[model samples]
Target: MWFLPDGAGITNWPKGPTELDALVFGHVFTILTTPLPNNQFAGIVRGYDNLIELCKRVEKDYFEKVLEH
Candidate 1:
């Protein structure tokens, strides 16, 4: 999965079909804005929050799939 928090980088991501294919293969991607009090220092906090949320969702989905099996 790819987590892009910068507007500029996110805009430039997936420059072509190859990148798009990679993105699709990754399955999950997020484009998030820096949270309040935005600054260079806030990136890590935002990234951590994004990762935690992603983990929670993935965990829930995994459990659901396992239960279904």
Candidate 2:
């Protein structure tokens, strides 16, 4: 719902005032609160530990099973 970006000021990632579609995207961090009923917000979380693993695999040089997501 609210987070600080690596570049600039704080961010509140909600496209609308509705309960749904609320997410925060930061350059170095991501924060999401108020879970959705469908767990749709799941897997969208970005953790610091994932940086190495993620940076190691780039879309330009990587492929995966469709079900991986």
Candidate 3:
């Protein structure tokens, strides 16, 4: 599992695909310029199936190829 707090690095994402079993994005909205309340910084936890599927979709749509303009 991985916990990404506000302003974390994506450069290490490649390292994660193999190491992480469950990735947790913490305080996602808190990273925005208009910061949310500390209490509002919720954690999103996805299961294995959903995580794998999400990764696949991201790879297919964003990482794997260029879009036709």
Backbone collisions counted per model: 0, 0, 0
> What is the C-alpha local distance difference test score of each model?
0.45, 0.34, 0.38
Q: If both were scored by lDDT, which would come out higher, candidate 1 or candidate 2?
A: 1
Of the candidates shown, which would achieve the greatest TM-score relative to the real structure? 1
Q: TM-score of predicted model 2?
A: 0.19
In model 3, residue pairs whose N, Cα or C atoms come closer than 3 Å (at least 3 residues apart or on different chains), thus clashing, are none
Report the C-alpha lDDT of model 3 over 14-37, residue by residue, as the tens digit.
444333322321122222224346
Q: Which ten residues in a row have the lowest lDDT in candidate 1?
A: 25-34
**Candidate 2 residue-wise lDDT, 1-69, digit = tens:** 122223445365554222221221222223233455654444454354343233233222333545476
Off by over 4 Å in 2: 1-31, 47-69
Name the better of 1 and 2 by TM-score: 1
Model 2 alpha-carbon miss at residue 15, Å:
29
List candidate 1 segments past 4 Å from native.
6-8, 11-47
Q: Which regions in candidate 3 have their CA more than 4 angstroms from the true location? A: 1-47, 66-69
lDDT of 1 by residue, 1-69 (tens): 333334534455653235543453233323233344555554544456544454445546545689876
